[model samples]
Target: MNGNQKTEPTINRKTARELELIQFKSGYEDGTIIAQQQHMNSVLGAISFAFFLALFSAGPDAFSKPALIVSEISFSASLVSNILLFFFYKTVSGKKDLEYIWDFEQTSYAEIFKTIALFAPIIGTFSLIFHYSTLAFIFSAFIAVVGFATFLLAKNQISLRDSLLSEYRLSLLYAGRDEDYFTLKKHEFKQKPSAEELKINKYDYSICNQKKELIGVVTLHHQAVVGDIIEIADSEPLTVLRIIHNERATKLICKEYTEDTSAID
Candidate 1:
């Protein structure tokens, strides 16, 4: 049915909580890294432009045609990278809500900038090395190595997060529905609920099956018998806790009530 025919009976609450927390933490780190990179981009862009201006101020003979070409390309590429980073950051950060699903979409754009940041330097450096001295080559080489390493690491993390998200979504899709519960109106009281009875003052109910034992609190709207099974708007069978005909909704005080499954049966 509805593609959930093979859905699992239930998910382990502890495991689910841990996974959600891990994703949240990773998302936070991703945001941090993006902010850091944005600042770096601005600084790098200014430096690149300054270098370009300096080359012109040196006059035509300052560097050979080939050298000038290489330097110009490197500086321009660096400048463009900075511009792209600015736009990327602006777009992603503009959104106020940061849901888990939205993480993938945001990170994908950031990843593109990361790729450009990684390659632009390498290409620029290699080009410059041909025109400049051995020192240039050494510097470019170092930047290339670092950029490549950063790219690889970021790629791996993105892949891992994507896999985790996929698993989580699939689990959510296939999760099976268990029994639900509801409360009844106090006015409909067939017999006055004893003072010792755990009354459902709010929408929350302490449901059980046949025996009077605690199951879990289920939120619902409407009135029904305390021990009887009733179907709510969702069509799920829920055990009734306490009935309420016309009462003001009060702050929910969820005190666990004990009952056995056999009580309902």
Candidate 2:
């Protein structure tokens, strides 16, 4: 009976250890996925920011007014979407429980935002090209198609090569990492924008209620004309009462909008 009891406890211990290892493996896989997603977001954000900066630096004369405006709006949207997704991933990964991390499924909104981040820059580029010259645009389009096809062909070849490699060799390639290799290092989330980093040249809109009470401030990253109705988060739609422009920033003074507001001369 004592021998049987000893054996039973040993089995229980083994089972517990196995379960712990399974949990660890699951967490590591999830963490790896999150890490990959974060990296993708970083790349998209950088591309979007680069395009936005290029457009801004080119001033108003690089392209036709309408084309330039569309490109700027598209790139800005992409940049904002990428930034939001990066923060979403960071928030999910910051949870203490690994199970929570595994349970976290990205929403459809995230997928939509990611799609925008992926294609908005391309759209913006094409818009500018089309505005400049049809022949140049067509040539650029052809080159883009060829480049994408080549990338796919190269990727497929690499995948086929990797498939033929033995599991032992693959394992060896992944081995010899430090203890924290699978662990994701914590990232410091910046809470506030630095004084030097402030975008003073951008337009910011301030929303107020009917009583002239301040509601909130928003940066639309685009031009806001007077009498335009704009939607601010967690608030009713506001109408642009006036636009105040200065050397540093442009402010759109807004108030709660109604149908009558538009009728007013």
Candidate 3:
């Protein structure tokens, strides 16, 4: 039989709400130290590989004595960038900011720096093309950008941790089929949400305060039925509550409904 002969069970696509919930849950869990280190090594190796490719493209004349200085300069800059990335990974590894590394709100230090480094090949290639090749400038720029991004990522992540530890952020997120219910609409200072039923169908679905300030979340008291209009509230998001009801209308909640101020902002 052909490889395609095997049959597989059908799988339903994840709803926005389901995907959001999965992300939320994953954030709460932490990755092992080994996994974090492996991530760093992978990035460093990739950057080094790209640099080699750049050097190869810089032409045979690169080996000539006059061009030696420029080639070395490019290599040095790429080296610095890689070194900085290594430190960034090490910093994260030691500090254990797995949450921030994987956070939607934050970009990984490795990614930003590695990206900055990834541009090094362009600089080297250009240097080789020009008669007065100065690979120094390009490599220097790469090093500077990646270095700065690494510093900023580290600083921001540390600052975020300190701030969160000091006080709760009081945030809420909702996403499903309705802008009113699933997509986060608004928030207020006072955590004010009582058991209210947003009746889309005749069913008296309920909503309550989900977040305790730091990060409020909500769930169906029972397995969410197909037509339940659940309202959610968070103290920081102050007044807006997500009103989820049905599947056919999830997109309505993405941007336009978020602009309306019917819920608290």
Candidate 4:
């Protein structure tokens, strides 16, 4: 879907079914895995900040020092990676509600990370070997920290790509994440599963209710790991937010059904 496209109240079942086929919620919560991602991101930010502090504190003396080949290479790699990030951000998801994600998604940021990771250690080793280096220990330290940060980021991206998170979709019927609406089969819902029957932790899942009647299913981000439902709403994000206030967030998301939806699958 386009970044500016209007979203549907109920997503089609196609995406949901496809995701299920791949066993989306079988093993672990995506959020659990994403926590590690956040850790690497925090470290990367720290390195950038530390490097600048070192450069500023030393001033002209820092520049008078000779630059190492690895330092030059790392700088070049950083520049290219940043440029790629700019282009990718402008292309994939431009000016949208989930724009906040663009901050973590630094575009070819993954690639930049890998480049730095691959080169930083080499540079560090070279610096230690050629200890008669032109730059001060602070400069070498900055490169070491930045390189380690990049390595961590590269590892995270390579293994965990949350393809289905924060994506715009058709509706709950087609929800792949927790907090989507499911079309209730009259026979099964007749039992009126208790709230506990519906709540599944470690992974997102929701039971749909209308006027206290079970009519559908919805997968909720009770955790809000990715973009929020508010980002995908048509009338108002509050329309959905109001759901959490009125009932359980999932209970508020109504399922699709005809008045005579009595048949069971």
Q: How many backbone clashes does candidate 3 have?
A: 16
Flag clash pairs in model 2: none
Angstrom error of the Cα, residue 8, model 1: value is 19
- Worst 10-residue stretch by lDDT in candidate 3? 249-258
Instruction: Count clashes in each candidate, considering only residues at least 3 apart in sequence or on different chains.
Output: 25, 0, 16, 17
Give me the candidate number with maximum TM-score.
2
- Give a tens-digit lDDT track for model 1, residues 1-265: 5885764443564466677777766645446545666687787777777776766764774465676677777777778888776656656663353343246535877568667765665565466565557787778778878999999999999999878866755555566411211121222338654343334332555444435444444655443455556443433465454543335432221223445688785
Residue ranges of candidate 1 with Cα displaced over 4 Å: 1-25, 28-30, 61-64, 95-113, 135-265
Better of 1 and 2 by TM-score: 2
Q: Encode model 2's per-residue lDDT on 1-265: one tens digit a residue.
A: 5765654344545776777776666644547557777788888888889978887676656554777777788878878887877877777675464455454443665457678877887788787777668899899999999999999999999888666544534554578543333232233244674353355335576665555567788876457887888888898888888776668655667877777676567
Using lDDT, give the best candidate's number. 2
lDDT of 4 by residue, 115-220 (tens): 6644553453454334355466667778879999999998888556433332332344465533442232222326553475356433233332345454334455
Better of 2 and 3 by TM-score: 2
TM-score of each: 0.38, 0.42, 0.27, 0.26
Question: What tens digits encode model 3's per-residue C-alpha lDDT throughout 1-265?
Answer: 6887955433367766777777665633434433544565456546556655566564765566455446446655665776655565556643356565556224576567666565664555455544353466567667879999999999999999867643432322222335543222344235533343222113233333333222334443343443334344622222324445564321111111123476766
Judged by lDDT relative to the true structure, which candidate is superior, 2 or 3? 2
lDDT by candidate, in order shown: 0.58, 0.70, 0.49, 0.43
Worst 10 residues of 2 by lDDT: 179-188
| TM-score of candidate 1 relative to the true fold | 0.38
RMSD score of candidate 2 (Å): 25.7
Prediction 2 global C-alpha lDDT: 0.70
